[model samples]
Structure formats: structure tokens, C-alpha cells
Target: MHTLAQLRAGQLAGIQRLQLSCGLTEFPPEIFDLADTLEILDLSDNALSTLPDDLPRLTRLRVIFCSANRFTVLPAVLGACPGLTMVGFKSNQIREVPAASLPPQLRWLILTDNRVEELPAAIGACTQLQKLMLAGNRLRALPPQLASCTRLELLRIAANQLEELPDWLLGMPRLSWLAYAGNPFSAADEQAADAATSIAGIPWERLQIGQKLGEGASGVIHQAVLQQTGGQQDVAIKLFKGAVTSDGLPRCEMTAFVNSGDHPNLIPVLGEVLGHPDGVHGCVMPLIDPGFGNLAGPPSLESCTRDTYPADKRFSVDELFGIACGIVSAARHLHQRGIMHGDLYGHNILHCGRGRSLLGDFGAASLFAPDGPHAAALQRLEVRAFGLLLEELMERCDLPAATQASLTALQAQCVSADVGARPSLEEAERLINSLRA
Candidate 1:
């Protein structure tokens, strides 16, 4: 939130990051003063529509975010930047993405909530690309050239106009997390209606909201008390903030949560939220145990697609096995019901010190037909994610020689470069159970 006055006075020199959002309509020439040091620039929430042709003057820039702005086209000058690799232009008026606009060394790109109908095949030139966010767009198809990006790991194409997912996407060697709900091919609404019939709906009047528990990009979780005929019960209520989130629609998330079904390692949804005065969507679930905390933190800028763990975090062989078994079982349950927990990172998991784990956060989950064409491939894609999780946990665990050898073998199988060769969740669970035995 640096001010133009401070920047003009050279008060922001020698800084690696610069953010200015005081309704900027023009590129400030004073920014060149910090070109030697600025590596990240955030010009979000402004009135800007374009970038200067000399944006390459910032030779050190690596990341630039211009979300919530007025840009209708992704700046072509971005490709000329020598070191820029990360770009975010979310919530803009962007309708066109020039092939020349993509940075040569791009590793991450976000074009969410825009009017983009197609992507340049040039995106395939970015072989180092690992993550992409294109939700809330008008894309009707994905470039087949994207299959050449072997390093890609996470993808969000929710709320787009795709008639169907590309076959190449399911067979990608490195893809793990994926969300494709709210598209023309999505059956989310129908699945949600079926799931809703099996669950009770709790009226808003019966809920007594309390202190806020936490918040995420999609919704707020709060501690609340629900009045029922039997008595009053403590619960956690999640009220969605809006129709669209970075992942997809709130109702889609709500559908995933309610439909996740019963599992020891899953957060149980008690009921659907009924009758919010503002017409906001939400759901109710059992309050999580106070002793539980996140297993790990979300990825830092440097880590990109992996979760970060506490510096001193260490797990015993038993604890590691417990977490692995629980996650595999939860995943098996999800895949069995044709659900894909698109965001299955350690950060989305809650763990008690005793090894009990609970997987939450349905904001990125998607529902698919179990017997559908891509169902098998989709399950295996998630298995690669599980493999990565196992590898991370193994790094922190104190394992016996024999146990380490076994887990490492299983991890390798889970993350095999050949997607079709990866074990299904059921098989992964079996292997995990064998390890515990």
C-alpha cells in the first residue's frame, strides 16, 4: 500500500517489493528509480488499463500483480521483461491475451475472472510453467500444446465455458491438483441436489453465530450454536462471501462438502444452511476438536506448489503411518463417490498430536461421474498429489531402515512419471495398511 507521494520522494528505494494502489491511472515514471531492487510489483485495485512499453526497465522484476484493475488486454511488454516469471491479472476487464504477452520464463500465470475465450498456443513455450489459474473466464477449449508442459502441477479452470476437459490433461505426468466445476460439462448441480436430499437443512434462525473462527478466499468459518428440537448443539458454520472465488463458485464448494459423506478423516457436514436473509449460501458442520491444528502451512512464494512445515516438525514412524492411512482412506472414500479433492495439500489437513487427522476445505473440490471417461485418470492424478505428500512427510519422519525402504517404494509408485501406472487410492490404502501391519 505504498503511496505515490512516498514513491515520488524516493522513500521506497532499495526495496524488493513495491505496491501502489491509490487509484493509479497511469504508470508512474518514478518507479524506474527502484528498478535495480524491485523484484515484485503489485498494482492491484487501481484504475490502470495498460503498462508502459518500457516495463522491461525493471530488469529485476520477477512477479507482477495487477488484479482488480481495468486492463482489457494482458500487456505485451510483459514478455520483454528479462527476469519476470510470475504474473497475476485477476478480476480485470481482460478479454484478450496476446501471444507475445507471456513471459518467456513464466512459471505461474493467473487470468481468473476475465473475459478470455481462448489462450495462445504460445503458452506451451513456457515449459517451466508449474501453476495456472484461469477460473471465471470464457474459455471454450484448452490448447493441446499445453500437454508439453511436463512440469505443470496445479490447474484451476473452474467457471469457464469448456464443453469438455481435454484428454491430454488427464494424462499429464505431473498434474496433481485440478478443479473444473461450473463449466458446461460439469454435473455439479445435479450431484449437489442428490447430496442435499440425504442431508437435513438447518434454517438460519436456528443458528446463533459467535466469534469468527477463521476465513479463506471463499468463506468465513465461525463458531456457532444450533438450536434443535433435541437441544442446542455447538457447531461451525461456513458462510460464503460471494458467488465466485479464485477456485470457483461457493455453491460448488458447498456441494462438495455436503456430498463428501462419512469418513473418520473427513469433516462431517451436518446440514445445508437454509434461509439466509441476504440470500448468501452456507453450510453447517460439526465443530472440530480444539486440539487439532493445521498439519502444515500453505506454500510460500518460493515453495510454489508444495506445503511448508514447521522448522522443528518431526513425526515418528507410527504418526507418519497414521497420517498416511487416514489420508488414503479419506481419498478412497472421495474417489469412490466420484469426488476429487482438488486441493489436497497438507495445509488443508488438521492433525491432533496423537496422529488423528481431519481433511477439510472443499473450496476446490469437484464432483465427477465415477464411471465417466476420465474418472480413472482423475483418481490417478490425485494419487500423484498423495505421493508428493508422502514424500514430504517422509522427509520429516524418523524411520527405521526397513520402514523407510518400504514407504519410499510406495511413494515412488504413487508419484510415478507414468500417470496410468500410479496406484489407485484403494491400492494405496492397501499398501499403507500393509506398512502399518
Candidate 2:
């Protein structure tokens, strides 16, 4: 957020990052003054269309973000950066990503919400690649060469025109998080069974909304009070903001929440919201336990695929097993109900010190018949994600070698390259339960 005045006056020097949003229509040549020290540049939320040809002058530059801009093509100069590894051009008008636009060491790339109908085969050359985000685009097919990226982990390709997923999509060894909702080959758009049968509909007027609890791409969660007919009771409310989210549609999220059924480790959906002003969509949910907090933060620029936790945090072996058991049990139940909790990750999990935990957030969920051909692959895909989470938890546990050996063996089974070789969620749960005996 440094201002142009500070930069011009040399008030900012030897800084490694610079973010400006003054709506410049051209590149700021003044940036070169700190080129010797700058490692990251962010010019998002501006009217800029291109970068200077000598952008490589910043020899230490490694990450660049120009999202929400007016670029029709990825600036070719990005390819010349000696150390660049991450690039983002989200919500732009980009239609062309030249074969030469990618840097050699590129690891994470984001091109969400663009007009990209295709990706260049050159993308396969970046062997260091890990995370990729390409949601909300016109892509009909992904470059098959992407299959060569054995290290790729997190990927988002939702809201596209693909008729079918590539065969290799289910084979990536390190892949864990994946979102392909809103595509042709995906299951037909799903509608929840009559929600009234499972949960009541509460009038919005009868509830008092409070301060925001949290928010994500799909909606805002608020602490609320259910003005009961007899008295008042505390509750949680999720008021969805309509539009295409980074994941997909909010209505789809609502449908998934309503139909997810019930489980002890799942946040209870008390009812659907009714009579919202201006027809806003929402749901009534139980207030989460105050003792519970998110297990980890979302991925970072460097750890593009893994969750980040506090360095001081550590868990006992019993606590780790309890958390793992609760999550795997919930996942097995969801799979039985024909629901895919697509955004399963450490960030989406909450837990108390004693290993009491809940798996929440249905924004990336989708419906599929458990008997369908793709069902097996889908569940195994999530098993890999769970395995990664388990590995993380185990790494922080002060457990003995004998206990660690067994859990690591199970994780190895879950992340095996042969998707079909991965155990079913139910089987994985059973194995986890056995570990505690």
C-alpha cells in the first residue's frame, strides 16, 4: 500500500514487496529505483494493461500479481524474469498466454475468470510447478502435457466448458485439492431433495443478525439469535452473496448444505433462511463451539498446496488420532450420501485442544451417485487429501516411532498413485480406528 509520493521521495527503499493501486494506465518507471531489492510486486485493482520490457531489471523479483486489470495478453516480459516463480492475472480480459510467457521456474499460476480458451503446451516445461488456479474460464480442454507435472497439488478448474476431464486428472501423484464443478462432464446440476423434510425454514424477520463471524467467496457468516416463539436462542446464520464465486455458484453451495444430512462432526444446519430482504439466500446453523478454532491457515505463496500452522503448536498422539477419526468418519458419511466435499482441507477443519473437531463449509460440494463409475475415483481423490492432512498432523505429534510407523503406512496407502488402489473412505476410517486399539 505504499503511495507514489513515498516511492518518488525515496521514502521506500530496500523493500522486498510493493503494492500500489493508484489506477495507473502505464507502468511506473520509478519502480526501477528499488529494483535491486524488490522481490514481489502487486499492482492489482488497477487499469494497467502491461509491464515494461526491462522488467527483468528486478533480478530478485519472484512473484507478480496484476489481478482485476485490463490485460488482454500476459505480458511477455514476465518470461524474461530470472527468478520469477509465481504469477497471477485473475479477473482480467486475458485471451492469449503466449507460449513464451511462462518463466522457467514457475510454480504457482492463477488465471481464474478470464477468456482463456486454451493453455499453451509450454506450461508442461515448468517442472517445479505445484499449485494452479484456472476457474471461471472458457477453456474447453487443458493441455495434456500438464499430466507431466508430477508435483502439482492444488487445482481449480470449475465453471468451464470441458466436456470431460482428462484421463490423467485422476493420476497425479501429489494432487490433493481439486474443484471441477460447473462443467459438462461433471454430474448434471443437482437439486437437493425437499429440504423441508430434513430441516425447517426459519423466517429471517424472526432472527437478529449480529457481527460477522467470517466470510469466504460464497457468503458471510454471522452470529445470530433465533427469536423463538417462546423466547430467544443463539444461532449462526450464513447470508450468501449471489454471483459466480471463485469455486462456482452459491445456490449450489446452499443445495449441498441443505442435503448434506447429519453427522456428529458436521456443523448442524438448523434450517433454511426465509424472508430475507431483497431475496437474499441464507441458512440457519448451530453456533460453533467457542473452544474450536481453525486447525490451520490457508496455503501461502510459498507453500502453495499445504496448510500452514503455528510453529509452536503441537499435539499428543491421542489428540491427533481423535481429530483424524472425526474427520474421516464425517467424510465417509458424506460419501455415503452421494456428496463430494470438494474443498476438503485443513483450513476447512476446526478443533478444540482435546481433539474435538468439526468439518464445515459446503461451498465446493457436489452431488454424485455412489454407484456411478466416477464415484470410486472421486472418493479416492479425497482420500489423498485426507492423507496429506494426516501427514501434517502426524508431523506435529509427539508420538513414538511405533505409532508413527502405522499412521505413515496408512497415509502412503491413501496417496498412492493408482487412484483405485486407494482405500475407500469407510475402509480408511476403519484402519484409523484400528490404530487407536
Candidate 3:
């Protein structure tokens, strides 16, 4: 409650918490002297451009909220504070983040809605980081060193200008939650909307709906057989519920599928169908029938934990590598055509036949635009997700020792936290081919 004119040096000594949400254009340098006991500071919704260089003197500080500020650069001195754990700098004007400026003990770093172009490789030094929010930035790539953050769990880097994702992101065993969309490569085309509607026009009466294949936040998928086609096809029909129709997600997915054309390793979009009175909308795809003696369907990495399976039965490395190669090839083709499959994971990939894989699910695809402001950020997120997927595949012990080593090394190169450190899809393809040979 201290007035701006009455604020003094010794007045803040006993204050453990401070909220300066009003009438403060700048933080008085004298405040940093309170480092002896101050634990929390809230300077949000202010006009401040930069933090005081001496502010890190507060050794006891634990959390700092500096959202909605005009900060273009992070204070170098803040990294000197050993006790700092959480830092919120969302909705700022930050343009770059040098690795040497981060606090070593930081656990949660939120920097959403800034103009950051890249992340410093030194970020991997912060092994304690668990939750990182880098959404709405201008990053083009990620540093490879990020794989060192073994404790990281939640990473949200949506809404940027990414072209490709690296392979190492899948290795983080603790990572669970991830969200990346609105990238140039993942952008939806205007023409794709009509195609989605057309694809949704498939006749349900002409096909037999079998078991449920999968479900997502948007809709459910089912395995079905078409009597006219004379063969079974894996159809993922998305019934737009209460709100998705208006959100343009269905149209986006449709556009991506229609525009992507066809590939052997990609699920062919046969057609789309809609239900009467807006009850449902969906598309038809080829069914990947499980051969005799094989499991009903491929299990997600999460579902294959040791507790879920008998000790004697385990996933094989060769199978996982085959899946990885197929996905990489599909992604390579998509990127070459100026498209980005926003979401890439084991669940989105389907094993069509022996050594054959198909990349499906265009619900999150977008067009690639390298000149846009967000291009780099989008690519980094994709790389991160790819890294995570590769890590999951390499975890299979049944994979041959030599094969596992080769795949692991390739994944490590792709998932590098530094976006620039990640290898191009073409380079990745060569690596995979070498292993195949």
C-alpha cells in the first residue's frame, strides 16, 4: 500500500510478498536490497521494459510474476539467484533468449507470447525443468541439448512457424502433455474444406462398422468393411459433436487429406460422409487388418508398460524401427509439399502390412510458410514431438543391440533442443537408409 513517493529502502525488509500492480512505471532499484527475506514478487500488468540488473540479489526469492510487461530481454542478473525456481514472463516483448542467461535451478519457465527466435543450447543444463511453455513465439529451431532435461513433463510450443520436427523429443520418459498447432506447415487450406465434406459423403449402409479403433478430443474412429469395395478398410469417421463443426477443425482435416493425395506409406483418403441433421461427419480409410497370430492392434507406448504385459512378452525393436522409418518418410514428403502434419506420434501411425506403414490423421495439418514470423517456432515444436516418438521406439529391448544403437543415435540428432541442430528430413532419410542397408 506504499505510495510511489513514500517508498523507501528499509520499508521492504520485512515484506515477504509484494504486489505492485498499480501506478508503477518502473521497479525502484532499491527493492533488490530486500533479497534477504523476500520470497514472492508480482509486477504484472505494468509498463516496465526491463528488470533491474541488481534485482537478483534477493537470495530468498522463490517465484516471480512479470507477465504483460514490455521486456525485450531477460535480465542477466536474475540467473545468479540460486533460490529462484519459477519465472513467468508471458506476454512480453522478448525477441531472443541466450543460454547463458537462464537460472540453473529453474524448474518451471513460462515464456509464452514473445518474439523469441531460438533457444540456447545451455538450457539442457537446467535438468530440473519439468514444465516449459514456449507457445506463440518466433523460434525457427530447437537446441539438441534439451534431451538432457530428463525430468521435463509438459511442453507447450504451439502457434509458430515450424517446418519439421526432430526425432529425439520422444526420448523424454517423463514427458506426457504436448500441444503444437498453428504452424505454417500445419496451416489448413481453403480448398480442403469442400474436399472434407465430399470425403464425408461415403455411404455407411454400404459398409459394416466393426470395433472402435481410436478416439480423440474431436471424434471417434472405427474399423469398417465396404461390401462394394470388396475389402475391409480402416475408417476413422469423426462425428462433429456440439462445437467442433464451427471451429473449422473438420474442414481443416478434410483439406489436408484431399490435398495430400496418396502414398503407399500413407492412409489413403477414400471418401467422406456426413450424418443427417448434423449428428456425424467422417472419412473412410483403408483398414490395416492384423495378420493371423498377430495382436488385434498396435499398442501405444503408454499402454505397453511392464505392468500391462506379461514379463515374457515385450515389444520388438525391429518392429518399432520399421514404424519410425515409415513415419519419417511420410513426414519428409509432406514437408516437401509445403505441408506440416501438426501432430505426429505412434498413435497417429498405422502398420498397414508387413514392413509397410501409413501416416494418417490430418486433423492438425497446415501449409508451410518460411517467410512468416512464426516459422521457426513451429519447426521447433515439431522437432520436439518427433524426438519424443523416436525415444519411445528405441525403448524396446527386443531391438537388436546394433540396430538399437544406430536408431538411438539418429533420434538423438533429430530431437536436439536447438532447432538448428536438428537434421533435415532428407538427412534423416539417408541415416535410416544406411541402417536398412
Candidate 4:
């Protein structure tokens, strides 16, 4: 949170990062003083509408964030920054993204909650791109040129106006995590609506709300007591914030969570919240054991799209194999019911630290017609995510030569370059179980 006063007084001369959000309406000329050292710049939560055309003067700048501002057009000068790779302009009024605005070395781009109608064909020039977030936009179609980004992985296009998923998107070899719910094509599906209504509702007055347990982009979880027919039951309540999250809408998440039925490695929703004073959307879930904890932390700035683990984090082959089995089984269960856990990351999994794991967080999950044209491709795309999870686990674990070879073999098959060539979740589960025998 660098202040304008400090920047102007030369107190922040050697700083590598700068953040000025105190109602900035224009770029401070003093910023040019740190051109040789500045690497990251954040001007979010401000009243800015434009940037200086000489922004490229910050030669070392590699990341920039200008979210929650008034920008209507992405500055073209951003493309001239030789070292800039990551850019974010979320929650702005950006309606136009000129082809020249995309950085040459771009790896990640976030444009969530914007009014973007289309992407430039020049996006193909960002062949190094890996992650793209375009949820809550007005996009009706994706350019075929996006196929040139062969290394791309995570993508979010939810709450958009797309009439159908792109055929090229289904075939992206490296694509793993994807959220496309709330689009024009799938929003009216009767199956999802039926699933949402099938779940029993628990009156809000019946809940004895307790301390907050945790929170994510879409909702907050809390310890609560539910009054039942014969007794009170301990539970965890998730009250959605009712905002367009990075993944999609809270309504979509609630629908997917309720639709995903009971599984050994999946948390089951007990019932939905009814008659809240504020009309808040929420659900009742069984309390998780206190012993359970997240397997890993969410991605950091440096990792970009991968989960981060504690420096001393380590797992034995047996433990990792057990975790793998549970996740694969849970994935199979979801796919069988036409759900795709768009976020199949370690950060979303809770483990008892002995191999037992629970997959939660349906904020990124999307439901598709089970027999739809892209069903197989969608499942396979999630397979790549699972495969990557296996890779992350393997990197932190110690395994005997033979056991390592076996698990690596299964992972290889799961992450095969040909989407069709990747083994189905059922097949992967079977192969993983074979290792135990």
C-alpha cells in the first residue's frame, strides 16, 4: 500500500512493488523515478480511467493489476512491456481489448466481471498463455485462434452468453480446469433445476448459528446446530454471498453441490437453507472432523496456476496412493452423474494426513448433460487436472523405485496429450487400486 506522499518524497526509491489505491485518477509522475527497480504495480480500487502511454518505462515491471477501476479500454502500452506477463483488470468496465493491448510474453490474463463481447484474434500471439479468466462477460463465441495456445491450462467462461462450448476447447490437450455454467446454452437445463429442488430445505429459524469456520470467494461456512425432528444435529452451514465469483454464480455452485450425491471422498449437503431474513442462499452440511485440514495452499503469485505446499511437506507412496484412490473414485462418481469438478486442486481437498481425503468446494463445478456431445471430452479434461494433482503429490513424496514407476505410469496415461487417449476416471481408479494388491 504505498502512499503518494512516500512515493513523491523519494521514500520508496528502491521498492520493487508499488500499490497506490487512495483515489488515484491519474498516474503519478513520481512513479517514473522507480523505473529501474519496480517489478509489480497495483492501482486497483481507484478512480482511474486511463494510464500514461509511457507505462513501458518501468522496464522491470512483470505484473500489473488495475482492477475495480473505470477503465473502458485496455491500455495498448501494456503490450510494449518487455517483461510483463501477468495482468488483471477484474471488475472494471472494460468493453474493448485492443489486439495491441496483449503482452507478448503473457501467461495469465484476468478480465472477470467486465463487459467484454469478444477477444482479439491477436490472442493467438500469446502462445505462452496458460490461464485465462473471462467469467461474467457478454461473450457469445470464442475465436478459433485460441486453439493456438497449446500450453493453456485453466479457463473460466461462466456466466457468459455462449450458446455452446467450442469444439476446439473440448480438444485442448492441456486444458484441465474449466467453468462454463450459467451460459445461455446450459442455463435452462431441467436436470440442474430438478436437482436443486430435490434437496430438502431446513428453515433458517431452526439453525443455531455458531462461529465462522471458513470462507471462499462465493460463500462463508460456519458451525451451526440444526433442530431436527427428535434432536438437534451439529452441522456446518454454507451461506452464499450471492455475487458473481471468479468461477461463476453462487446459484450454480449450490445446484452442483446438491446434485453431487453421497460419496466417501465427497462432502454431502444435508439440506438447503430456507426463509432467511435477508433471503440469503445457503445449505446445511454435516460438520467435518476437526482433524481434517487442507492438503495444500492455493496458488501463489509465483506458482500462478499450481497449488503450493509447505516447504517441509512430504508424503509416502502409500499415503499418496490412498489420496489418489479417494479423489479418483469421487471424480468417477461425479462424472457418472454428469458433474465436472472444475477445480480439482489439492487446495480444495481436505485430508486427515493419512491418505483419507474429502473433495469439497463446488464453486467451480459445472453440470453437463451426461450424454452430451462433449461429455467424454469434459471428463477427460478433468482427468488432466487429476493427473496434474498426482504430479504435485509425487513431487513431494518419497517412493520406492517400483512404486514410483507404477504410479508415474498411471499418471502418464491420465495426462496423455490426446484427450481421447486419457484413461477414464473408472479405469484410472481400477489401475490405482491394482497398486494396492
Candidate 5:
């Protein structure tokens, strides 16, 4: 949150990062002075319209964020930054993304809430590409060349105009997390289960909301009590802000949650909020048992596709088995109902110290038929995501040589390049149980 006054005074000299949101309408000349040391820059929430042509002078720059600006085109100068790897321009009016704007070293890219109807074929040249976010765009399809990004792990193409999922996308060897809920093809199918049927309407007046429990891109969760249900009982309530998130619509997420059904490792929806003066949407569920927290933090810019854990984090083989089995069970339940948990990262998982875990967050959930033609391919893509989680857990544990070998083999099977060759989550759960025995 650097101020223009501080930057001009040269007080931020030798800084590795800089952020200025003082209603900028042009690139600050003072920024060029930090070319030798600045590695990250954020100029979001401003009226900036363009970047200087010689923006490459920032030799050490590795990341840039210019979200919520007035740029109609991506600056070509970004491509000249040799070390740049992450870029974001979310919630802008940019309609054109020149081929020269994409850098070869790019990893995570965000272009959410834009009017982009197409992407350049040069996207295939970035073999190092990993996470890509293009939600809330006008894209009708993706360039087939994207399949060349075998290292890609997370993807979000929801809230677009796509008529069908790309065949190559279904075959991407590393694509794990996906969200395509708002597309015409899948949006129709997502309504298969009338949310009104699976979710009961509970009035807000019957509950007493308490302090915050947690918050995410779409809503805030809080501890609440149902006063009218015979006796007061503790529950968790999620009140949606009703915004278009990078994932998709809030109602779509609510639909997926309610229809996900009962599972040992799922935080099932017990009731849905109906009446509120402001018309805020919300849901009620059983309060989580004490002593549970997120398994990991969301991905960082440097580690674009993987979750990060604390330095002292460690899990024994038994605890790892329990965590793996719980996740596998929950996934099987979702897939059985033709639902895809698009955001399957460790950050979306909750775990107790003893290996018990639960999976939540439906913002990225998408719907398809269990017997649909694309079901197998979609499920296999999620298998790759699960494999990554297993890999992370395995790397943190000390186990016998035999046990380690077995776990590694199963993970390999899950993330196999050939989609059809990958084992189902059910099969993975079965093999994990054998390891436990």
C-alpha cells in the first residue's frame, strides 16, 4: 500500500514489492527508478489505461497485478520481462489480449470478469504454464493448442459462452481442478436437482447468528443457533454476498452443495435461508466438531498450482491414510451425483490432528450427468488433482520403504496421462484401505 508521496521521495528504495492504489490514470515515472530491485507490483483499483512501452526496464519484476483498471488491451511490454511469471488483470474492461502480451515463463494467469471471446494459439508455446483463470468471459471455446501445457494443474473457465468442453482439455495430463458451471451446456444440467427440494427454506428470524467462522470468495460463514428447533443447537451458517466470483454464481454453488447428499467427509447442507430484509442468501449446517482447521493455505504466486503447508507440518502413514480415504470417499459421493468438485485443493479441506478430514466449498462445483459421455474424462481429470494432494502428503511423512512404494504406485495410477487408464476414486479408496490393513 505504498503512497505516491513515499515513492516520489525515494523512501521505498530497494524494495522487493510495491503496491499503489491512489487512483492512478497513468504509469508513475517514479516506478522506473526501482527497476533494478522491484520484483512485484500491484496497481489495482485505479483508472490506469496503459503501461509504458519500456516496461521491461523492471528487470527483476516477477509478478504484476493491474486489476480493476480501464485498459482495453493487454500491454505488449509485459512479454519482454524475462523473469515475469505471474500476471493478473481481473475485473477490467480489457477485450483484447495480444499474443505478444503472454510471456513464455508464465505460470499463473488471471483474466476474470472480462469480455475476452478468444485466446491466441501462442498460448501453447508457454509449456511452463500451470494455473489459468478465464472465468466471466465471453469465450465460446479454447484453442486446442492449450493441450501442450502438460504441466497445467488448475483451470477455471466458468461463466463463459462455451457450448462444449474441449476434447483436448479432457485429455490434459495435469489438469486437476476445473470450474465450468455458467456455460450454457453445463448450466442446464446443473439444475437437474431442484435446490428447493433438497434444501429446506429456514427463515432468518428463527436463528441467532454469531461471530465469524471463516470466509471465502463468495461468502462469510458464522456460528449460529436455531432457536425454534425444540431447543437451541449450535450450527454454522453461510451468508452469501451474492457476487459473481471467479468460480461462478452463488446459487449454482448452493445447488451443488445441497444435492451433494450425505457423506462421512462432507459438510452437508441442512437448510437454506429464505427470508431476509436485504434478500441475502444463506444456508445452515451442523457446526463442525472442535479442533479442525484447513489442511493447507491457498496457492501462492510462486507455487502457482500447489497448496502450501506450515514448516513443521508432518503426518504419519496412518494419518495420511485416513486423510486420503476420507477425501476419496467424499469425491466418490459427489461424482455419483454427477457433480464435479472443481476446486479440490488442500485449502478446501478441513482436518483434525488425527487424520480425520472433510471436504467443503462448492463455489467451483460443476454439474454433468453420471452417465454422460464426458463423465469419465472429467472424473479422470479430478483424479490428477487428488494425486497431487496424495503426493504432497506422502512427501511430508516418514514411512517404511514398502509402504512408501505402495502409496507412490497408487498415486501414479491416479495421475496417469491416459485418462481412461487412471483408477477411479472408489478404486483409490479401496487400495488405501488395503494399505491401512
Candidate 6:
């Protein structure tokens, strides 16, 4: 065992790993001398502003954790570490990403909760990258070169300033998972109101709140009937609770749902209103005829698991394939329009009967610019989520042999740890269509 003072000496020749967590602010310069044999370093929760210049000497280093620091810029020598693969720099004061500063072997880059407004175009050059997390930033756009990263798998770019998404996002052959909520452009009008404010527009006799649909992080959803309307339309209304104490604005999750708008596979928004004084944010959406519960709900997951083994008692393989295809098609449509469904899961997808499936709950969606750093990150995250969903479906026991084989192969390709190995929405659609035929 190494003595406490000897480990602090920074001259320990055989030291391969070092962890300094508490009671330290700055790293001594002499620490760089051990770079030759060091493979891992943990210096999180410090007040570090910069790294030593001679860090590149650690040719064998592979992982570095430097989260919760005061770094405005990355160390210049990080890119020089030839064997480096993973780097964590979350909760920092970073403003920009310099392309030339990243190492070629980098595979995982986590930069969440930073002040970064832009990314280097050279990021796409790192073809080996897999998981890239850029949540809680100020980025307004993404770079087109991102499509070149054929190996990327998981990406999370939630909470940015994006306004629209690039068209090529849907064309990425390997992407599957993503989440990009809390963007200004994607904020819906309904999400801007509160409970009292939403009901102010329509008279009480005209609206009748029905069964409780579900509850979200900040509000509750209910099935409603508009008696005053000549057509007697059935609608879904979400009532915002008293969570917005800071600025009186609706929560980010509520905004994502209202902004999604109308689609055959989506719950169409009829109107939005805000009740006064109480400040209730509510949205009116066309209700599904039979009111199919979400797949992620307890009932659905339990049913699927219980019916897995007995092929005769399980849901038909054709029905499962049809549902998957509908999901992919809806995702493609949303991506083509520059929208990212940040929170995609079985629970968010609702069956509309007759081989029709609707992608509901846009409470986590965002619109990003076509060629901005934010969009690139959002697309990558979506690819990762898609892979996970596919994996879940394949594990179901009741699926037919042929359908299971095809789906398993597709899921394997989409969920590859390498982000670039996942299939694009278009490719997934094609594969689903072929299976249907």
C-alpha cells in the first residue's frame, strides 16, 4: 500500500490510478510526471480551472473524470493523449468546443450542464465516438458533418436553444435514440398557460372533464367532452399543477406536449387556453376512440411479460410487427419536420386500433436548427433510445420465429454500443416494410 504523503508526492513511478475527491482545489503540476503509466484519474468536485500542460506524457491513460469544475476551456494536451477514450466534464463553465482539441480515440464524451453555445465541426471526425451527452447547454444549432460519424450510438442533447432540426437527421442509418426538450422554439402555446387560465376562454357548460387519462411530472391529463361544440368532440386535456413558482411559465414537459400539433399517428391538438388568476395551462386534443393505454404503463408491460412464452396465447406476431412499423413511421415524420421526441418509450406510444399506432406525449420534444451542434447531439440521443426499445421488443417470448429473427437482427444493429453502427429511421422503416411483406 502506498503512504498518503508518498501518493501525494506525484513521483510514484508505478502509480497507474489516482483518485483525489475531497479537500483539493488545484492539481499540482508535478502530477503530470506519472502520465507514462497512469491509466485512470478521478479529480471530480474540485475548483480546477485548467489542467497541466504536460498531461500528454500519460500515453497509457484511458479515462479521465473532471466533472463539477470551473473550467472555461479544455486542456490543450488532452487531444495529444493517444490512448485516451473516455472523458467526463459535466457541470462546468465551458463556452465552446474546439474541434482540434479532442483526441482521435475518444469514444465517450460527457459535457452536461455547461455554458457551451456551439460545437466544433471537427467533432464528426471522431468516427469511433459512441455515447455523447450534451444536456443542459445553450447550443442553437448543429453541424452537418455529424452524419459522417457512422459509429455513434447514444446521444443526449436535452435543454438547449435549438429552433429547428436538419433534414438529414432522419437519414442517419445508425441513429436510434435521442432527447431534446426545453428549447424555446419548441414551446407550445398551451404549455404557456395554467389551470385557471386555460378554462377562462371556454364556458363551463361547454366543457366536461371525463376520466383521468394520466399524470405527468407537473400536471394531470383527463379525457374531456366539449358539449357546446356542434360536433360534440372528444378531447384530452392536461391540467398544470402549482409547480411553476419561479416565473409562472408552464414546465418544460408540458410545453413539449402542446407544441407537437396534429398527425394521424399523433393526438391532434384542437385548441389551447389558459385560465386566469389560478394560471392553469391546458390543451385540448382529439381523443382516441377506444382509449388505448400506453405501452410503458404497468398493464401493458405486465401483459406482455405474462404472455411471452406461450406462442398461442401471446399477441400475434403480425400485430407486434405492425405496431413497431407504425412507431418508426411516426418517428420518421417527426424528425423530417425538424422535431425531436425527447422522451420516447413504450409508455408514450398509444394504439389507435385497426393497425394504427399514435406517438403521444410530446412533452419532451424540441425543434433544432438543421446545421447546429444541438441538433447533431439530439439526433444521436434518439438513435440510442430507439435501440433500447427494439431490444425490449425482441426479448418478448411470444413473437413468431421469422418475425423474431428479423427484429433481433435489426435491434442488434441499432443498439450497437458504437453510435455510428445504428440504423437510420429510413432504414428501419424499410426493414419493417420488408418484414411486413
For each candidate in turn, the TM-score is 0.96, 0.93, 0.51, 0.95, 0.96, 0.54
Report the C-alpha displacement of residue 227, candidate 2, in angstroms: 2.8
Question: What shift in Å separates residue 167 of candidate 6 from its native position after superposition?
Answer: 1.5
Is candidate 3 or 6 superior in lDDT?
6
- Per-residue alpha-carbon lDDT of model 1 for 1-437, expressed as tens digits? 79999999989989999999999999999999999999999999999998999999999999999999999999999999969889999999899999999998998999989999999999999998999999899999999999988999999999899998888999889999999988888865446546555768899999999999877767899999999898999999999877778888887787777778889999999988899999988989999988998899888777878999989999888889889999989998998877899998998889997789999998888888898888999999999999999999999998989989988998999999899899889998998899799
lDDT of 5 by residue, 289-317 (tens): 87999999988777887899998989987
Q: For model 4, what is the alpha-carbon lDDT of residue 66?
A: 96
The C-alpha RMSD in Å for every predicted model, in order, reads: 1.6, 2.2, 12.1, 1.8, 1.7, 10.7
* Model 6 stretches astray by more than 4 angstroms: 1-6, 9-18, 29-38, 188-250, 254-388, 392-400, 406-437
> Distance (Å) between predicted and true CA of 348, model 2?
0.8
**If both were scored by lDDT, which would come out higher, candidate 5 or candidate 6?**
5
Compare the candidates by TM-score and give the number of the best one: 1
In angstroms, what RMSD does candidate 4 have relative to the true structure? 1.8
Per-residue lDDT of model 2, residues 250-324, tens digit only: 666766677778788888788889999879888889888788888888888878778899998798888898899
TM-score, candidate number 5: 0.96
Q: lDDT tens digits, residues 1-437, model 3? A: 44444346465567877767664677876667666778888888888887776676777888887888888986666687788878888888998776656888888787877888888888999998877777678777768799899877667566556664555664464554454445554544334334344443667677677788676534677777766655654454555442221112455556667667666667777777645344566777765655412212333222421112234444455566576677777877776555667657556666543455667767556554544554544554465556667676555446667877877887887767556667777677778877866
Say which candidate scores most in lDDT.
4
CA lDDT of each prediction against the hidden true structure: 0.90, 0.85, 0.64, 0.91, 0.88, 0.65
Report the number of clashing residue pairs per model.
0, 0, 49, 0, 0, 54
RMSD versus native structure for model 2: 2.2
Per-residue lDDT tens digits for candidate 6, residues 278-356, read 6676667677766575655421212411112334323355656667788877777776656777656766777643456
Off by over 4 Å in 3: 1-200, 203-210, 225-236, 245-248, 291-317, 352-354, 370-380, 398-405
* Residue-level lDDT for 28 in candidate 3: 71
